[model samples]
Target: MNKKDHSLLTRSFKNISVLFFIVVLLLLFVVILINVLFGIYTWDRLYMDLINALVGVMIPLVLFNFLYDRFTQQHKDRELSEKITETMLLDEQVIDRFSNDSKKAFIQKSTESILGKTVGNMVYDTLIQSYLSKSYQYRHHFKYYISYLGDKVTKTFAVDDETIFIFNPDDYYFVREDLSFERDITNFIQSNDVRIGFSYKESTLDGLYQRAEFMFRENLWVNEEHNSMLQELSNHEMEQFVKSFLQFTIEIDGEVVPYQVIHNEGYEGFHLLLDIPETLHSSVLSKVHIRFQMPQLRTQKKFIVMISEPTEDVEIMFMHLENEMEVEAIPFLNEAESITRLPNDTIKIDIHDWILPRAGVVFVWNDRQ
Candidate 1:
């Protein structure tokens, strides 16, 4: 249910509960009042009067204990509910805090913080639906988190830095391919409440804040641009693209030299980047290899590279991934070409190579997944 409905139900529950208890309290008071007047006019003995006085005191004390216990739990439940509502409100406000650039980044970070470094359309969709299904997993934790209601509630909350986001952890069936930041966030918060209890943990707030702050200090979604496309580029284009993207520059003989990346005509697909000594600026002593296309968000496109000194004996030894994805070491040149995974899943390929250069080296791997 939505926040309004959830809150309204909570209020209704509280109001009815309180009204019922108040009526009981009033009945006891009326009885005492009636007895006092009757004893004042009808009683003839002090002993009888003393007994009535003791009875009046005992009745109020009983009602007081009953009301205190009931309201104590009621107050606790209300506090937890308020926190949950606050979390939802904060999430709604975040819709404006982010920009198009950081949207995917923030979502990936938020997802990774919970599900770890795993990527696939299936994994993302499953996690989202699992929270929305009737099998509300977090219900008990939220229900008993702040009160003694125990684990009767099946709803959950991802409490944040002064914000609370409701969640569900259960075996549910919901398969949606269009998994995105807004959709997932909305589904996570709009889930129906189940049972009645609470579970409080400081980490809950930490998780929510991590994502909320994604574009807070710096608007990540606004300015950060992601370039992930599969295409072939001529050597000249590759050089300019990679250099600009990496801001790559080198110092030669105490002076900074900007190197141009070139695709190998003989290899047909290898783009090379090396700081050419002014002497061998024409020689082929380049040091880097261009592999598969660049990656983005949670997509681990086949990003690979072979790096070694032209003077050293080596086969593909390194790769990088600045994103989330699973990559395998595929030997390109020879069976003896030992392969190793890249760092951070980021193979910074200058995919913008399509702008300049013509057929010098033919890029391999044209099939799309």
Candidate 2:
């Protein structure tokens, strides 16, 4: 290296050191000046120290409050969900109890009168009431306008080994995949021992009437034990029925979502499991059409038998018989062996047997729906 280059490097290094010293000295001077001013103002150093310490404390405290708020919100959300589910379940029971012979004539008369006045109105009335009775709330998002493609829409209702459901002018577009509303609905129906059928309105009031007439005729003429009136169907008859009649949309954030309600018997308690998209699990609300049959009162206690998720926690609500003098206390008798894993996610439960009678079971979801 040349002497001139070495001298230039030394000078540059000296300047850098002086700048660094000035910066450090300035920062120290600011701190000292702050302390002196604070002292002159008769401020306690300990108090100031405590204030600073509190600021440090508040940083975490603020973070903790934020976390706590989130957690509390979640808890409140879960509680609200549970309440809605419970109300929906109760409404289902009320509607089911109302659908007996006692109310059948009233329903028919009202339904018939409504049908005469408007097309596809009969089924709409029934579905709306049935759903509204068991839902958080109900709103007619849109009016159904019936237009017939053919001469008449033929609907056949038949009973077989299993109960069948039929309704006209289906709003299948309301079936949403995100809400798991279908699952919630099926659970409500099964809990109440109900079944349902679905149909839709075509273009014109006449077409709606024709479809309603078909459903009414089928319901009246078909044997009470009939599964379906339509014959020559393959093994997937019920599947076909579900595909054709029941139309629904999943409700999320007050928006209607498109989905199909596929009949499922995989779970003993429920007859249908709605295959929904994963995205809808958290925000979707469900509306189910169910037909509940009152448990036969063969003895002093009404006994109902059902199968459900063995490991699942369930809540039961019973409708006290009107004439009964005293309500019987429910006794749960788990007959199955201790299982680490539930059997087929189903355990047969008897509501009234040798011990107790006339009880209903409601299943609570862990907000997965």
Candidate 3:
């Protein structure tokens, strides 16, 4: 037998020896008790005759046997108790080892499951259905983290940041494979109560696989963004201005980035600047295009068109000006108005000026040129 088997046999033998000794000792005690009871039953007649002659001899022998048996039994019990304790200790160690190994196996399995093809497909598909399905509507607020899907797209927006955009797929645009995008959308239902939900769509899949993939990751529809928008817009006095629509354009090195517009809303006369994904940010600033909506207001002719980076540092060249005034209203005409340089490159163009009460200004950003 192997060394391990031999050791196991030896341990078993020791336990068996302890048990045998305990049994033998217990049997001797039962025999002694039976003999004492029998002797007591005949004590008057038998012991009376034999007591005088054998009592002295019998007493010493009986005492010696009793003492010897008691010590032997105690020794056997101690050995058995020690062996039992040792076996228990060994069993506990084995149990602990098994528990730890099982836990490790479970952790490995769980990790594989989360990243597995089936689970990924399921998550992606659910997200898509939540948006495209007629059961729910997504409005102004949208959110998502792109890196979780290996750097897809990430964007966060308030309700007031809404802009509308249109796209023409046949135009010159950069396309890359293996890109996936996810978003949580909020919109109002016909009942006036705002409904919130999650949806995800990816760019890689060909044809209908695209729609099938996003339906699997749908989760509970919650109204957290609605409350946030209500509080912010009400506090800012911009509540009446309600979000119109939103659009996104991805640009890389002055080239258009091709992305399917899953949804859009509120795209009339307001100028909008939708944040393009940073992967395309550098390309945008290299040669950027500001897609702005023209104002339908009557006073729009009085105000000149000027675009400046929100952080006014260096004066970027002005794009368009109204001809109604004898003089041009140039933004960089006053150098002091320039504040600080943007840490990162960005493109800002003033499509139309903010008007007073005569013409309320609403800027909408759209992706469509």
Candidate 4:
């Protein structure tokens, strides 16, 4: 029966029980009055008979109520099980799409809607355990992690079998970016403007800030047109020339932020170590701005931005001096959501979905020959 029908039946049964008890009491009072006035039976005999009748009636009534309640509960459980099975059959793909943790949560919510909080939790435990057992199969020793009611439990399942590990989605970090590059071909210079926003997930430090790192790398390649002059410079002179043309500024939320730079021994890049202020710790999103100007030689036909972190949204725009150069931008490894060319020799590419590291955009340009 449905919940409403079950409730109505229970109420009706309770009312019948109360009415029967009242009727018994009235009958006993009438018997007592008859014995006192008309002497229908002796007081001792009447009391004994009354006690036997009461016991007989009460015993059967209590037994019937107990059996009925048990049957109703069994019916409800069976019905719920059938519904769960049907849902699984219809939404197999949907369920498979959810991560392990999300699957557990979905099961809890779906079951809780049909049962009381306490019973729902009990049902959730049984269902989730069954799901994990069937979904995860191992022949030998396997270490499995399961999240039950917000608690994580790790246990070895099946010794002498292949091991399988499940990764937690929460452990993944994601960031968003808005990057722009402006080229001034007249001076062989390019200005880069980047804005990054992210949130902290894991950290191990004390104080009002969390330590983070950012790396920047720029390489200069000489072509036939400029090889003679560049090749004449010594290694030390070349490094100095590259450093002299690079000017950058870092800011957090509009205010300038300080960082310690660590230059690579043999590379054309450096690393910046800074602390994220406590104000943007776990609650608020943090925004970092990096702007830099570097030499853009004629031989450098392409500028690539590599995604080294999990990114959700990225907007890249490239603007060059009109009538000076032509550029084309393309996404590597993944397709962009939108690519638009605006006025003033500008091109913009946007990626609006989650993209993993190593996938990024490449901008290729050439002089207007």
TM-score (all chains, Cα) for each model? 0.20, 0.21, 0.18, 0.41
Global Cα lDDT for candidate 1: 0.33
Show the lowest summed lDDT stretch of 10 residues, model 2.
212-221
Tens-digit lDDT string for candidate 3 (1-369): 999999999999999999999999999778666766877534465457567768668888999999999999999999997785466446766435556446444434444467785765564455333433434322111111111011222222344455322222222111111111122211111222211112211111112222312211211111334324323333223212223212333333445633222222221111112323345422212333212111112222222222111222222222221121122323333323322222222123222222111111111222322
Over 223-291, each residue of candidate 2 has an lDDT whose tens digit, in order, gives 222223332333366544544433323343344433332333321111233333344445333442222
Worst 10 residues of 4 by lDDT: 139-148
Rank list by lDDT: 4, 2, 1, 3
Q: Which candidate wins on lDDT?
A: 4
State the lDDT of candidate 1 residue by residue for 2-105, as single tens digits: 99999999999999999999999999778767876877534355558769899989999999999999999999999997785466447867655767445545
Kindly indicate the candidate among 1 and 2 with the higher TM-score: 2
Go through the candidates in order and give each one's C-alpha lDDT: 0.33, 0.36, 0.33, 0.48
Tens-digit lDDT track of model 4 for 165-190: 22222221111123322111111111
The per-prediction tally of clashing pairs is: 36, 47, 34, 6
lDDT of 4 at 189: 11
Name the best candidate (by TM-score).
Answer: 4
